[model samples]
Target: MRAHKITLAALVVAAGLSLTACQNDGDDTAATTDPSSVATTSPSAGGAGSDGSDAASPEASSGGKDTTAGAGTGEQSTSGKCRTDGLKITAIDNFIDGDPQGTVAVEMKNTSGRDCVIAGFAGVDLKTNEGTLSAERKGEPGDPYVLKNGKTIAFSVTYPLNETGGTGVRITNLVVTPPNETKSVTLPWPGKPSLPVTDGSGEPVRVGPIGSAGQGG
Candidate 1:
């Protein structure tokens, strides 16, 4: 009877061990097959969705196309207005026939090798031994002139003839300043040494607005 009881106890212990092993195997299988666990281990987990919605988005690709569309046109990046340093200026005496008395044309040529703009009136001053005489501006300014490479623009200066034969101001040089520029260029007077004018007169010499090369006079 004692042997039989011992054998029965051993059988009960084996049965309990077998049941625990089965339960542990079932738990491991459930963990490996779970949907959440499979998704976290996938290679494309955070990338574009399974339908590729994020990869095909318009906002993602539009920026690259916009940046390269109009890069090489060059017209949008044109050089700005002309400056005195880029011009070749010359004074022409009596350039126009039948022009009003004592009129001289000053021409400014664009030597900048690029297109630029010139407008309004140029500042003109006659340099004499006594002092500098500023020219009075006449007429309203016209449209702005676009000076192409190697092209020219001009303006006219009208001075009193001093027909009275009295002693006149002797002009040694002409100081010319382009419109909107602070610098100036000095050139020798084109014609006579003396610019005859009535003394103590208010703004005897007059300057006109800029125009086409020969049209100013």
Candidate 2:
């Protein structure tokens, strides 16, 4: 009877121990469990930002297109006009006071790099300290200039300078308006009127194609 009781006691103890171990294992699993909530809140890592940044874009994309044409490489040039590439109605050439009355041959260069269909005429206005002079059209019927890609066209016209005669004349504004883009070139004429080419005496300068001896009034 004593042996049987001891055996029964041992069996009970072993069963209790097994149950306890299982309970401890279940508690450990519950502790590690997560409450399903957080998802994609922030960026995982380095990703594209909202700020548009295409560092590897082609050069054409950087400079954009020049109307119908493409961007010119470093080898290309805009010629005499400071209007630069893709400029419209650019003042490529200018003759200051070739005539005593102050004649300025306005040379417009279309740096648009596009084939421009000739349309409205280009006007040249002479600005003085007094005020603005009437705009004059160059050539017959003020014919439109049909400039090809990277081409320059010059139109000569005369305008009156300031009443006060001198070598320097102030130009209030000089603009060339084309059918498409309008570009302007302006220089402050302070004392009187000075040409791109001046004399040693600092007199009125004369500029034009060779063989044209301009007379001053």
- Candidate of highest TM-score: 1
RMSD of each: 12.7, 16.1
> On residues 84-156, what C-alpha lDDT tens digit does candidate 2 reach at each position?
2343333323435454555444444456656543434443445655555545333333333344555555444
Choose the strongest candidate by lDDT: 1
Kindly give the stretch of ten consecutive residues in candidate 1 with the minimal lDDT sum: 70-79
My TM-score estimates for the predictions, one after another, are 0.61, 0.35
Quote the positional error of residue 55 for candidate 2 in Å. Answer: 53
Return the lDDT, model 1, position 189.
81
- lDDT of each prediction vs. the true structure? 0.77, 0.44
Model 2 bad stretches (over 4 Å):
1-85, 88-100, 142-145, 161-172, 179-217
> Cα lDDT of model 2 overall?
0.44
Residue 45: error of model 1 in Å? 23
